[model samples]
Target: MINLTINGFEVEVEQGATILQAAEKIGIKIPTFCYDDRFKPHGSCRICVVEVEGARSLMTACCIPATDGMIVQTESEAVVEARREILDLILANHPLDCLTCEKAGRCTLQDLCYQYDIEETSYDGARKSYEKDVSNEFYTADQTKCILCGKCVYMCSQVQNTDALCFVDRGFETHVGTPFEQGISESTCVSCGNCVSVCPVGALMPKRREKYRYWEVDKVQTTCSYCGVGCQMELLVKDNKIMEVLPVTGHCNEGLLCVKGRFSFDFVSHSDRLQKPLIRKNGELTEASWDEAYNLITSKIKEIKESDGPDAVAGFSSARGLTEDNYLMTKMMRAAIGTNNVDHCARL
Candidate 1:
């Protein structure tokens, strides 16, 4: 373990730990934009700059290793000024459309601006603008709102192991896009929406949610029921109806999801969902009350057991059911019906 001083407080950390990691361990926050725990650190933003004693210039805390007996000042006046200037440079070329952006309330850039009390853009520079690319059915990309932090690029190419996005040009004209400048729908993109989840600003957003602002909806955190992957997702509800789905970080899925788990949740409230039991009468199907359906099933099961023995009855389970429900189904099949032939299609 290496001992260091962060913000005048003694902290012990691993030998190869970064200054940002040590500060985070000691409850000292260093603002950052391009650093994600799940991805390799790219110190391109320069917002986590900190002053190290005996150093000639401020170093990026995210990339600088914490050495023993090193003294780091996270929030000195010079450090704060440098961070504000870096943030100003980022905001100079960024679009000023936060009110209607999908990442409005949850945007990291907006939070950092508020933290530094930056009321306006200090530099009057020409803002770069790009046409909104909505070619993909699942998501849209607006390069004007992009901070060039490479979060989406790292998430798609490195973390998810899907090289669906990459830097396409050189220098100031560089921007993230698919190969051959093809639309995401025309490329090998799988529409997992991991890039959308990691975007710090409004560059990447869900296509279905473009009509409404983020603050106009309610977010409900719930476990995904699609597969046994057991990923955590947020159901964006509006007016008692589901609007979209967003994956949560550090969960079972690591903020990544398949197409089925991300977009197939509309079946939850589909009109074809069975709300009540159905019975066949006079060669036609008719809706029946719960009590009537229960009685009919019970009578049929009793008749089968009495005539053909308990082995004549069987029950099937579904994988979509909760764990407790599956457990109860197995218990009832073995204990009540005394039938070992009972099984579930989910077992296949």
Candidate 2:
């Protein structure tokens, strides 16, 4: 264990733990731009710089490991100035379009600027200009809004294992792009949208922005219905309409989702979606109420069981229903209805 003093609070953490992790253990919130739990520590943003008692200069808390008897000042005057200057440099190139930016409500850069009281840019320098690339069906890449934090690049290569994006050019001209600057659709991009989920700014965004803000949506934890794997997902719903589908880290997926799980959710609100139960009446299928449908199904099942014995009745459950529903259907067939011919559409 290593002991460290952060903002006069002495704390102990496991050996080789970063100063940011030590501070986080004590509820000390340190603003970060390039730090993510899933990625290796790449102190590129310099937003979490802090002053150590014996260090030559301010150190990035996200990468610096905690040491025994270390005295760290996360909010010291020098650290504050360094962070302000860093933000100023970032803002000099960043576009001032928060109001119209698709990531306005959920942008980490905007929230950090607000927390640091940075209302205006301190450095007025030439800004990088690049056209928006809407070639990807799932997302748009706007280089002008990118901070070059490399989060998306890391996610693509490390998490998704698809090296579709890379840092192109050098220094001031550096931007995330595909090979030979080709369109996203032309590259090995799978449109899984894992890049957009990790982006801190408006550099990467969904092509179609939802109508509601981030806070306005009700996050409902559910499983993806696209396949039998049933990867967990967070359904962002507003006004009874699904606004977005975010991948949740749990179940079999482990923060990973295929293109179908991430982008093929529009069918939930499709006009052709069935809203009521359907039954075949007079050789034609027609919509029916819940009570009517249940009564008709009950009568049909009872007639079959009595006329041809309960062994002749069969039930085929669906994978679309929950596990409990399938279990109940099996129970009804074997115990109540006296049949052993129950099967699931998914087989397993």
lDDT values, one for every candidate: 0.85, 0.88
Error of 1 at 244 (Å): 3.1
C-alpha TM-scores of all predictions: 0.87, 0.88
Per-residue alpha-carbon lDDT of model 2 for 1-348, expressed as tens digits? 878899999999999999999999999988888888787889999999999998999999999999999999999999988988888889999999987787888899899888778887877668899999999888899999999888888889887889899999998899889989886889899899989888899999876656667878899999888665778988888999888888899958888788888888888889998999999979999999999999998998899999999989889988767676788999999998999998888877
**Least well predicted 10-residue stretch by lDDT in candidate 2:** 206-215
Cα lDDT tens digits, model 1, 198-230, are: 888889987673366567889998877765457
- Residue 268, model 2, lDDT: 89
Candidate 2: RMSD to truth: 2.8
Largest lDDT belongs to which candidate?
A: 2
Go through the candidates in order and give the clash count of each.
0, 0
